[model samples]
Target: MDTNHNKGDKSFKIPGDWIEQSKQLKEKFSTLTDHDLKFEEGKEKEMLERIGNRLRKNREEVLNIIKEINLS
Candidate 1:
């Protein structure tokens, strides 16, 4: 029986060193500033989709890493 409250949440609890890893991940993705990013003249939609996909993947990766640490 699982008694964890955050089990279903995509958000992971940061455990010691994993906290640092999460911070690094956030810093890495923070480079994509709206003002600094440019899309091709006709590729606005495609660019948005690509950014969304990357964000989702990155989030999952961070969560997984946190989970591993929590389990250990």
Candidate 2:
């Protein structure tokens, strides 16, 4: 069978779930409206911080996968 079917001839192919996660993260970050981010209000800033943490974690996972594939 074709174990590399998901990758095919592409140089890289991130797992499908990472793409979904990235989309969700983008949607979340996009919700921080200017009104919600007024100076000193902090709510929007805090929301962004939380999302940023999650994004970093997800990004690290994707990077690790990419590195592994490259090393092989």
Candidate 3:
């Protein structure tokens, strides 16, 4: 599946239920803000970058977090 985007972004895909996933992320990292999790359909790279910056994590780390959250 077309997972990564053109800029070599890791964890670019937001879960189908992002509202719930975003809630989970916020709970895990209380400092995360709505703006930090704001995702545009065609702007996954930007969103992941923002999230990685806010969480002090790499793209892969953010990907794993999202994967785990989706699994739960």
Candidate 4:
């Protein structure tokens, strides 16, 4: 379903509590939608691309944003 063909950000992995983290991201970044935050196995890069594109950021920024969110 992910149309991102960048083949980059291969080292990125979704957090264990990605569902919760995703909610936090959605709140922090209103432009992000459920579809953009959706996580499928082995699809981290694609999801990152969607998030980065929506937020007008790069892959690293997106990765950092996801890492900065706390699941607590």
Candidate 5:
């Protein structure tokens, strides 16, 4: 997995356990469908943007939610 982290940037790695994390996300946000959390290689940015847009949240907020899932 190509995980990158940069300060003040909306760049972060999709966790290796993304499949599990995505499942958690779907549970947290019941409205999210399988298509919403689909992970396409090389399209991580697009996926994140889609998630943020669907949830009406910013990139940072989305990242935080994903991060919280990883920590759990």
Candidate 6:
């Protein structure tokens, strides 16, 4: 998997194809709304934060979930 590390953190950049993953996330977590998964070109962090908040998870957990979806 191609990943970009965040400064001073183990957090990897959200995949460029996050929109597809976001769809899977919504299917997995029905609580997530379209607005919650909305993606912008340079707003990856914001998107992840929004998803994490909705799922009551941390950023790393959110990233892991996305990665898992990609693997499937």
Candidate with top TM-score is 3
TM-score of each: 0.29, 0.23, 0.82, 0.80, 0.80, 0.76
Off by over 4 Å in 5: 1-10
Model 2 alpha-carbon drift over 4 Å, by segment:
1-42, 57-72
State how far residue 16 of model 2 sits from its true place (Å).
Answer: 28
Clash-forming residue pairs, model 3? none
The residue-by-residue lDDT of candidate 3 on 5-64, one tens digit each, is 555633356757999999999999997899999978888878888899998998889888
Give model 1's TM-score versus the native structure. Answer: 0.29
Residues 24-68 of candidate 4: C-alpha lDDT, one tens digit per residue:
898888889999999888887788889989999998887777777
Which residue pairs clash in candidate 5? none
| Model 3 global lDDT (CA atoms, 0 to 1) | 0.85
Put down candidate 2 lDDT per residue, 4-69, tens digits, no spaces.
Answer: 774522333333454444444345456434432222332433433444354454434534533453
Task: State the C-alpha lDDT per candidate.
Answer: 0.48, 0.42, 0.85, 0.83, 0.85, 0.82
CA-RMSD of model 1: 11.7
Candidate 2 yields a Cα-based lDDT of 0.42
Q: Which digits, one per residue and each the tens of the lDDT, describe model 6 over residues 1-72?
A: 967676545435666577788788889999999988888767777888898999999988988888899998
Model 4 stretches with alpha carbons more than 4 Å out: 1-9
Total backbone collisions for each predicted model: 0, 0, 0, 0, 0, 0
- The runs of at least 3 residues in candidate 3 whose Cα sits more than 4 Å from the true structure, single-residue gaps closed, are 1-7
lDDT of 5 by residue, 1-72 (tens): 876666455556797688888899998998788888898888888888889989999888988899899898
Candidate 3 TM-score, true structure as reference: 0.82
lDDT of 2 at 6: 46
Judged by lDDT against the true structure, how good is candidate 6? 0.82
Q: Give the deviation of candidate 3 from the true structure as CA RMSD.
A: 4.3
Decide which is better by TM-score, 1 or 3: 3
